[model samples]
Target chain A: MKARVHVMLKDGVLDPQGEAVRHALGTLGFDGVEGVRQGKVIELDLATEDAAAAEAEVREMCEKLLANTVIEKYDIEIG
Target chain B: MKARVHVMLKDGVLDPQGEAVRHALGTLGFDGVEGVRQGKVIELDLATEDAAAAEAEVREMCEKLLANTVIEKYDIEIG
Candidate 1:
């Protein structure tokens, strides 16, 4: 099975890297870009064949290492 | 309007960060991890409501600033 994880900063958190991108975009003349938020997408190739088990295991991975639970949130999709 | 962009390194590219993650996962006792790849997901809030135009603009952003185009490929999703 394959697992895809998207880890994003939680709401109300400040993202300086995203802010820098937004500012650079504005400077590049692409106006009307009101906001920007950046996150991580991790793709994992697992040895498991069961989708349910893969999802559960990937979720555990997220909680243990993939995501910073206090400041970030993660979503997992198993295929 | 909103646009979501997923930027990933090309298949042949070496991803040290992902390798480190995979190694860490093994050390943490999460076995059966065959491989790992990492990417970026960027969300943009646009002032325009037209999805078509938003997609086009975001594509331009990717070609010009968002993606390296040499080692990275980006996909745009307008919502």
Candidate 2:
């Protein structure tokens, strides 16, 4: 199975990196981009074939290590 | 309009960050995670309602600054 995990900073949390990217974009002449929030995508190749199990396992991975639950949230897409 | 850009390193590129994350996962006892590739997600809030325009603009942003065309590929999702 394959899983893609999208990890994003939680709302209200400060994202210095994201802000930096936004600033860089403005400097590069890309206008009308009101806001930019940068997150992460983690692609995982698992050894299982069961979609349900893969999702559940990946969720555990997210909660345990893939994400910082205090400031980040993660969504898992299994295929 | 809103847009989400997924940027990933091209295959065969060295991913030290991804390797670090994978190592950390092993330390945390999450076995069976054979591989992990890390990328970035840029979420933009655009000032236009035209989906086509948003997509085009976002792609320009990606090519200009959001992603490094030499080693990174980006996918855009507009809504």
Candidate 3:
């Protein structure tokens, strides 16, 4: 099975890296970009075949290592 | 409009960060993780309303600044 995880900052959190991107875009003449939020995507290839088990395992991984739960939220998809 | 961009390293390229993550997972007892690939997801809030135009603009942004096309590829989704 394969698992894909998206880890993004929470709604109220500030993202400095995203702000840098938006500022750089403005400098490059790409106007009208109101905001930008940057996040991480991790794709994992697992030996397990059961989708449910894979998802559960990946969720645990996210909680334990992949995400900073206080500031970020993660979503997982197993296939 | 909103645009979500996913930027990933090309298949042949090496990802040290992902390798480190895999190693850490192993140390944490996450066995059976065959491989891991890490990527970036950027969400943009744009002032434009036309989805097609937003996608085109975001693609241009990816080509010009968001992605290092030499070793990275990017996908853009507009909504």
Candidate 4:
């Protein structure tokens, strides 16, 4: 099975990197870009038998190590 | 218009950050995880009248500033 985990910065957290990119984009005449928030996607290939089990494990992976709950949230997509 | 940009490290590029996350996930007993690759997603809310033009400009944004083409590739999704 394959899984994709999306980790995003919490709404109130300041994302300087994303901001910088946004500024640069605006300078290049790509206006109408309200803002940019940078997030991460982790693609995983699991050696598991059941999709349910893999989903549960990947959720743990995000909660424990892949994301910082203080400033981020994660969602998992399994295939 | 709204667009989502997915930027991924080139297959051969060395992603130390991702490797570290993989190692930590492994230590947490999430076994059978072969490896992990990390990427970024930027969701854009465009104040534009046309999707085609916005996409072309965003592609330029990726090429010039949003991602380092030396070891990255970007895909755009408009909705």
TM-score of each: 0.98, 0.94, 0.98, 0.91
Q: Write the per-residue lDDT of candidate 2 for residues A1-79, one digit (tens) a residue.
A: 7899999999999988888988888898877888888999999988889999898888888988889999998898998
Query: What's the lDDT for candidate 1?
Result: 0.95
Model 2 pairs whose backbones collide: none
| DockQ, all models | 0.93, 0.86, 0.94, 0.79
Q: Indicate whether candidate 1 or candidate 4 has the larger TM-score.
A: 1
Model 4 chain B weakest 10-residue run by lDDT:
B42-51
CA deviation > 4 Å runs, candidate 3 = none
Q: Could you give candidate 3's per-residue lDDT for residues A1-79 as a string of tens digits?
A: 8899999999989999999999999999999899999999999999999998898899999999999999999999888
lDDT of 1 by residue, A6-52 (tens): 99999999999899999999999999899999999999999999998
For candidate 4, the docking band is medium
TM-score of 1: 0.98
Worst 10 residues of 2 chain B by lDDT: B24-33
- Which parts of model 1 are misplaced by more than 4 Å? none
- Name the candidate, 3 or 4, with the larger TM-score value: 3
- TM-score of predicted model 3? 0.98
